[model samples]
Target: MILSVALSASLALTGSPAHAATKPVTFQGFTIQVPIQWHAKKEGVNLRVITGVCSPQAAECQSFLLGGPQAVKYASEGGPYRPDQPYHPSSGVTECVPVKKYNSGQATRVRTSKAVFGAGQRARFTEWKVSCDGSELNVASYTQRVWYVKAKKVIVVDHWKTPGLGGILAKAVWS
Candidate 1:
């Protein structure tokens, strides 16, 4: 229920760096084929995937999140909260916790990288999650920010605070 703003690098689909093989994780009627090495932790309806990144800023940690409510939020873009924006607790969201919001104009970024995917269930609540590197979370990037939706929402988790990683999270989809 913690709504925080986040982003990574922009996806250069034309010729981006491909990682390991794809192993798709199916949950809640959707399949997520993330890099084969990522490990998954199933907690009730949410299947959390832990991905590895080789970087000096942070290593042996940081991952890409797949499946669960958040993924549905981005794929459909019809949820209740937008990326990085100040959170307004919605009735559909029963678990959201209040968190400090950054005032650096998240609305503009939401408009730019906004995307909607998946057909999740009739959302009973909107859940906000921020990607964490180790124990810290809410690292900011230029092209990422808050976005708003009409109904309940979900999210995909990502590490790093640059716009580059954000691109991969947005484009990645499960078959």
Candidate 2:
């Protein structure tokens, strides 16, 4: 009995069950592999809708928003939609970053670079660190991967200090 218990504990600790295959979750016209145990939900308007997902214990969920090139219609300086912007990876970071962070204080765009996702699709990747006002113990940080596919669509992948999720986005598959 002790041996069985130890074996079970080891399996749980090693997360052998969590290594099962990950199914692809589709949002808008794009699809990406959501890591095991992550949850996804779609919200917002047709062109502005985003399928967001996060680990159960995560503080913030990541948003997967994809739209046609003409979907740049920003309702406000920080609204989730941008109808005036072009199709670029950086554009996704600009539109997807919450406006409240900017309104609170200065948010830094820490880094930006090029990336590839899903069958060699090129994209723009960016990272941000937001320093809020006051003595708040927690601050906001984000990493975004944007893909402007030849289909004339823009795909934005947003995460908050969550590692590996971006890697899943990097392996996204378009249908």
Which one wins on TM-score?
2
| Candidate 1 residue lDDT tens string, 58-167 | 32234444334554433423443443442322223221111213222222322333344433322221223323222344543222233222243344434323233343
Candidate 2 lDDT tens digits, 1-175: 9999999999887667447556667765567766545555544432222235444534334444544433333322534333222223232233224424432334456666666667657666655454443345455434443444434355563444455555665777766
Question: Who wins the lDDT comparison?
Answer: 2
The local lDDT score (0 to 100) that residue 137 gets in candidate 2 is 49
Q: What is the lDDT of residue 32 in candidate 2?
A: 72
Per-candidate local distance difference test:
0.38, 0.49
